[model samples]
Target: MGRIVLNGVRKAFGEVEVIPPLDLTIEDGEFVVFVGPSGCGKSTLLRLIAGLEDVTGGEISIDGRDATELPPAKRGLAMVFQSYALYPHMSVRKNIAFPMRMAGLPEGEQKRRIEAAAKALNLTDYLDRRPGQLSGGQRQRVAIGRAIVREPSAFLFDEPLSNLDAALRVGMRMEIGELHKSLATTMVYVTHDQVEAMTMADKIVVLRAGRIEQVGTPLELYRTPHNLFVAGFIGSPTMNLIGGAEAERHGARTIGVRPEHIASGSPDGAPWVGTVGLSEHLGSDTFLYVHGTGLAETVTVRADGEVPLRHGDRVGLTPNPDRIHRFDAEGSRL
Candidate 1:
């Protein structure tokens, strides 16, 4: 494993500039996730690191060695793609062993490495089976196994779980987390899913329009996002962002309160009042959508299992002041 550095990295296609001059330092063995909306350049940045795309300007180095001009094969990184990219005609064993064979390893070493990777990925039973014979999750594992067999200095994943069903995606997410723990290799994962980024990343890099919005731990981003974009992007059910003028006149500006931070009814020492408009019960908890008062749109609040409130129910909403996030007129945190 080795540290990866990007110094004033940039990419442009003719006159359309995609990534601006950006700087990042990825520590050796760290699991860093790059997350942003589509066309925001997260995948482009990952490709730049993998040597799949060249840097139009700036320098890239791995373990103190400059690698801007190096080809993908010489970059000492393995990339797993969303499509699995398994060979339909080759058995799982052959597919996993292909990289080793290409590298011209001894027969004994290649066989041993393939067996070890297959065992680690729980694919020993499917070694003789082709990609066509395995399930979606199994096929993804084969793709991962192929990367593992190469034993590169770092692993790059580009939405590797996007192709799987919800349950399988969760399972594969856990598998990838476990694999990182066991291997402890440098990893850079690119995804638009905030849930995946939050749950699996040791550090999260939130991007917007080819620029980095913020970089921090999951909870750090959740608890204290630097601006409105991040405040809205990092959480589920999203955050309720009231306008700065309206909020400040009421003692706060651009007030942000999470769904889980709001409670039903006019609790003692509550901050604001709104009528309930809709409610969603998810077994473990209920979400109350409130309207009316200073807020322009429906604001969501979390309730304990099965809120008795219904549509058009006249109820008061209160936000915990300590839990609220205040942002300035420009959306920067205040």
Candidate 2:
């Protein structure tokens, strides 16, 4: 059982509190991702759970036992860092065997586990090579293989894909997701990239300034955000927030509509009308930035890839009323 619970957990450095008291529960076999902008304290929280850092207040429990004071080695958990952390001089087989060797496992056991992890990670043919001989993705797999040998109740990942290029990041995302399915082990991942969080997590914990803004499935956060910060941060291209007279007419201090929810055309009585300032054709979809709509900033609309709307052309936009989001003056969802 890999269930982890934090009760009134807080962290402080000298006199300043970084993480205020908070409670969270990560269920067994669940893939949870903590996401936020830089210095949001997502990594700090993960380290608290890993026992690498002690909580300033309250306690932590793993499988129902208090582990607030346990050292990292006694916590029965494995962590994969942003860095590969492999010994360059060691061969792939020996790199994976390092952990088992440190624990004084028998030679036969070490060989067995190394071979099994290698086969699972598609490194069977590369076992004789050194870390210097592999690509970025291959080196990362070796790091994970090292963790797999520990057989911990849970796995913690600290931005494991940030070092790779965009294409490699996408491939590794799928590989990690597949690994979770095959292992059925609880995994907690951390990242600043919302796209990665949306694609890989069973549950997502959105944090900001050391506090959790929300916790729910990807779609839950996407469909109904708790507040303005969440609404603006969770979506790609982000939701357009309109204020002033346009918002006052709707009986809200501010109004929000996603790009995809707004349609572009030349409807005579459309709610918003503006000139297309720029159009980006990305093959699958076209993103149009419209100006002069009498709102706070440029309104972006997601139109068909083949949209003929060009710069200097006037266009009308209508948002689906049912999909409109209203916010109060204090930025809370109404």
Best-matching candidate per TM-score = 2
Instruction: Tell me how far the alpha carbon of residue 84 in candidate 2 is from the true structure, in angstroms, after superposition.
Output: 0.7
**Cα deviation of 204, candidate 2, in Å:** 0.5
RMSD of 2: 1.0
For each predicted model, how many residue pairs clash, with residues at least 3 apart or on different chains? 2, 0
* TM-scores of all candidate predictions against the true structure: 0.96, 0.98
Stretches of candidate 2 exceeding 4 Å from the true structure: none
Put down candidate 2 lDDT per residue, 1-334, tens digits, no spaces.
8999999999999998999999999999999999999999999999999998989998999999999999988888999999999999999999999989999999998888888899889999999999999999999999999999988999999999999999999999999999999999999999999999999999999999999999999999998988899999998888999999988988999989999999999948998899999999999899999999998569999999999999999999999899889999999899
Top candidate, metric lDDT: 2
- Where does candidate 1 have its weakest 10-residue lDDT segment? 263-272
lDDT score, candidate 1: 0.90
